[model samples]
Target: MTDIFNKIETSFRASLRGEESTDKLIYVWGIISYVLAFLLNKLIKTVHVYFFGTTISAVLICYFAWHIYALKKCSPKKPKLTKEEKQKLREEKRKEFGKKLMRKLLLQESFTKWDPIFISIVIDAFCIAQFIDYIIR
Candidate 1:
């Protein structure tokens, strides 16, 4: 049991660092946001509460949007290469298939850090719109 817990903790940390797959974290955060919105609708039963929640959710959406924009801005762009250089690179990659595969996997893992933030933004925007409509009515 302790070993399982330790493994889980390690994996969670790795995911936080964008070194492991984050699909599950993304899904869990998305579901939790939706559930919170649903519960707020059912339990709050007040326009003021909904308005407050919507405001907070909108703020979160903005924050996540800014984060994504920053990430995109900070990402390094690929350098331009001539046709012959491209062909040479492709041939080298073909010769080193294992290294190419590893690099591809690493690049995929690195980008996964944004998945949860994107999911959160979408979920928060939806929830904000939902509660705003509820409040308006």
Candidate 2:
């Protein structure tokens, strides 16, 4: 567990250093999606695998978001905004946050992550298959 976290933390720092989080992030979530998918396949007997899937998907979204936020909070930093621009930026962020929250809540199959679209597609396809199988069975 600590090792997993340490790896992600290292990657997170690398991202702050202007490095990409491609393998670091996608591999981490790929492992997560695999384990979670396997568990849901064998253990969970819920009606909607998407329920657990969506929850875990939201966790991944939040993980990336929090990592970005932490990076922004730590690095070279940005120029201080003027009062007007600050308010506008804050409001824009609030709106964007609401939209993302809605997307996760809706379990939108069309959604894609900024960092890893293919990975998100693969994970979602696996989850959706589990869900459809549950319904079919």
Candidate 3:
């Protein structure tokens, strides 16, 4: 029992190490939770709603919580440029590609970074709605 608990603690700490680990942990817990929920719903044949609802909610909560932690912990890198360097780059871009193209490129760069976070937020919202439905029904 002590060995088992120690192993679990080690695994949990490793999962907290980075975004990748948290992401993998989310998938693992989601699958495990769903399987347990299904087993309880099928075998016990009672309290199915409770088991399924709680399991789903717990998984979502775990995912979102870890996601927020990962986001907070991993700070975005600062732009490596002085004011003069930035001005030179802006002038060069304007001369080479025009201001309109520069704006588009910047937008695309930011969008790529933000896209996953936006999608995850939408998913979290959907999960919350489903959890509410599970509770009400």
Evaluation by lDDT, superior candidate among 1 and 3: 1
Given candidate 1, what's the lDDT at residue 107?
83
| Deviation from native of the Cα of residue 1 in model 2, angstroms | 6.7
Clashing pairs in 1: none
What is the number of backbone collisions in each predicted candidate, taken in the order shown?
0, 0, 0
**lDDT per residue, candidate 3, 1-137, as tens digits?**
99989976776565566423534444554346445545633543455767665676566556556545553344344589999999999888779676656667778433234544445445555555655555566
- Which candidate wins on lDDT? 2
Best by TM-score: 1
Ordered from best to worst lDDT, the candidate numbers read 2, 1, 3
After superposing candidate 1, which stretches have Cα over 4 Å from the reference? 1-48, 98-137
Show pairs that collide, candidate 3: none
**Would you estimate the TM-scores of all the predictions?**
0.40, 0.31, 0.39
Reference-based lDDT, residue 43, model 1: 56
Q: lDDT scores for all predictions?
A: 0.57, 0.58, 0.56
Q: Could you tell me how far off, in angstroms, the CA of residue 2 lies in candidate 3 after the best superposition?
A: 14
> Which runs of model 2 end up more than 4 angstroms from their true locations?
1-4, 10-19, 46-120, 125-137
lDDT of candidate 1 over 8-96, digit per residue (tens): 67755655455544344445434664666577566545545756756655554554454334333333356999999999999997899
Candidate achieving higher lDDT, 1 or 2: 2
